[model samples]
Target: MVRLRVLFASCWCFVAAASFSQGDTSLIRAAVLEQWVRALSHDSMQGRMSGSSGAQKAALWIATAFRQIKLKPLSPKKSMILPATVETGRLRVRINNVVGVIPGTDPSAPAVYFTAHYDHVGVGSAFSESFPKFAPFHKKTDKDSIFNGANDNASGIAGLLSLARYFFSAPRLPNTLVFAAFDGEEFDNLGSSAYVGQQEPGKVKLVLNLEMLGRARMDSSLGHFPIVTYSRDDKWVIDSLNKYYRIAFGDTSRTKYFLPDPYPERQLYERSDNYIFALEGIPANGIMMTNDQDLYYHHPADEWQTLDYGLMELVLRRIALTVYQWLKASGGS
Candidate 1:
């Protein structure tokens, strides 16, 4: 018995050492999230509404971050700038989508795409204006003020940047990785729609759309998870994600599920940028904390202070690792 125990201990020690050795590359951390949210959600960005100066500034910042991370531009000459115009009544506003690419070592490998929208609801009626009876104390000062949108989407953009930085700095990836910061997601997903129109569906293997990952609530009930989500016709993706969620989070209760359906808040899956890619038959999915019922959503109170940075970092790291695993399994370029 003593000899057997000794042998088991030795094997355990070897396994632990191997796991440690695999940690040579650092995982996505909270500090990176902090830096990204701070910059993207700064008041100077002015809510980053599509076709607004704030959105343009945010685009420039995202492009700069991609450059700093050494990601090659997928567009011609390593850069792509797509211009779009939206007519809002008497106003005709123009917006642009920023795209970059990291070439994979395997020329024949498929491409994995990561996307996030940087736009949000611009300054508008205060929460109280819509709900005078339930107005909070801070509503008076925050009404009609710039919505910093720290959590609404800046968090997702931060995750996108962190993922890009990781892949750019790490050894050559097997599949081509495309990073896109979409504009006009809040309005009608115009940016992503335009992108889908230009590219062939066969080139994209997966689209991981990040959205509203800043806020963290205490609810662990899978029932609280977002409903009325959308994906491509591929059952493989749904099965894979369902398995991973059950194993990683340990929740196996299957709740009622369906494709995008019109709701009070509109069918969110069809409303966001991911819908554009999904329409093209790409296996696309979105990550978000809001269940479409958060009171602070799109409100001025949606500031950085309300975000759970720790949870945000965890989600981001998990997403990054999951993407890596999926690419490896899918034979991505």
Candidate 2:
């Protein structure tokens, strides 16, 4: 553990970046994404099950990163830790959501959120129902019990932190940026369910939840170009962003850079924390790169080592740039 902390400290140096002049994506470089994902999905984290020691550790780590990035806490407790309860039928467990704010000059500024749940199916037996839909892929004969969840959500959390850091360094926009590392997203969106009922109902402009972006999309023919989930009304948003992305990045390929959710039958959008916010009648959506096509979706093999850090870096940069552009334009066409 001591050695792990030491390595993490060294990796964190790249986080601050020796120079901020390069670009917005500098802090979110592939190496930095690897470091964040590695630390979050390390065996030492014990799969980050909600209410477990690992989850607590992860929460503290996120709050620390937010603090280091100078993001203000949303809580009056003078901390970034926001508490919630996860209800599992008969049992209730207390968990926490780590939230931070990059305030706009106006107190009335609409809030734009970047979120990802940080919990997984913890240490479970080979037969554990951690992933029921994909249970057929489980290797019951295998001895691995830890559900590292590298892509299931460690990647999302890494993306979350990276965006927070990027916005912290960028010039202020019309909206306040809120980065939330939610807990208990597994076990049926327990954390998100509790959070959507906050003080102000409609103060939200958009919630871009990052989930499972460390790999290529196996569910769609659209390839691995990053994608978002939204209903029919918001399809134009994706198309508009695609046009902007090509012109802004000089992407000549006709391949669409953004696509809508591919697995409506599997309820991919509802499975993520973003859905609960949408239930409250807010403009909330999620960005993801893979679905059930991921062979290791919930398997023990879903470790940090299996992830493509390069792909993840691209995912982060594209989504960060798009979201930032949206914020700057004040949710325009």
Candidate 3:
């Protein structure tokens, strides 16, 4: 194990020297990212289906990480997890949204949010489709269905937590920052919908949602730059991203990729948690490694082992840096 660690570090050094003259590859920890993804995606969480005991457990784990990172809870109750009820079809269940806040030095400043959902479709039922035959990774008569959502959103959770920890311990920014782990997103973005419904329009300056930050498409290599979709009217968000990204990395050759939803007619913008904020006239955007076309999406086959730690680290570090620069440029001291 020691030798492997040494070899890994050496390889990273070689790669860094070869490619990133201006990038800071050491800003984020690969081991920490790996640990979060592994624990969240473990079968013990039972796919982290919304409103299930498994989802509750996952919420607890996220709250613990927030506390350990020293982020103050945003709720008036002094709690990190906010409870909610979600109804899909005829089924209704209670769930949680884990929230942490860093009130800016200037409390009057606009707030910026970072969000990710930690829920997935639950296991198959007795009358549901055939087990392993239908799902390809399940058993013939498996009593408990495990749709361990590794890439679907576990990777997003890891990114959220890591960013919280990174910013909490660093120099204070000017604008307030909120980190949220939403529940019941799979059930029509219920978690985020509730959050946006309660907030006053324009109370938030920006919303940066992270989802499926794990794997790329089968034809693409791991960490192949993911998509960053923004609100139609929010050109400032994209401009800030590209501007600060260049400022932070000193790499003008590769601009931060931000695009409007190419298929607005498809309502693709409304598909994720960010949509709720967008509907409320708040400038919102999100990061996604892949869309619904990915083969492992929502499949039991999505596991921690399938992700590339090197890519995860790089992408997450870039996100942290880019966000920092954006907030700083927005007047975060």
Say which candidate scores most in TM-score.
Answer: 2
Residue 56 of model 3, lDDT score: 92
Better of 1 and 3 by TM-score: 3
The clash count for each model shown is 4, 0, 1
- Cα-based lDDT at residue 64, candidate 3: 94
| Candidate 2 deviant stretches above 4 angstroms | 1-23, 75-78, 126-141, 198-201, 217-232, 250-255, 331-333
lDDT of 3 by residue, 227-289 (tens): 556456776777777777778778766644544555567565678898888887878887776
Is candidate 2 or 3 superior in lDDT? 2
- Output the TM-score of candidate 3: 0.82
Q: What number of backbone clashes does candidate 2 have, counting pairs of residues 3 or more apart or in separate chains?
A: 0
| Candidate 2 per-residue lDDT over residues 207-325, each given as its tens digit | 78889888884435555555655443456667766776775566899867787876678778777888888787777777888786678887778998888888888878877776666
Alpha-carbon runs more than 4 Å astray in model 1 = 1-27, 76-81, 86-91, 125-144, 199-202, 221-232, 242-266
- Candidate 3: where is the Cα deviation over 4 Å? 1-27, 126-144, 198-202, 217-227, 254-256, 259-266
- Tens-place lDDT per residue, model 1, 1-333, is 999999999999998775443221254677778788878888888888777788888989988988887777775654555567755445555877888888898877778899999887655443234334324423534444778888878888888888887666555667888898888776567778766765553667778788887774544654343323345365566566555544433456764222233343456666688778888777787756665567667677778777777777666655555455556555553
What count of clashes does model 3 give? 1
Ordered by lDDT, highest first, the candidates read: 2, 3, 1
Rank by TM-score (best first): 2, 3, 1
Error of 3 at 97 (Å): 0.6
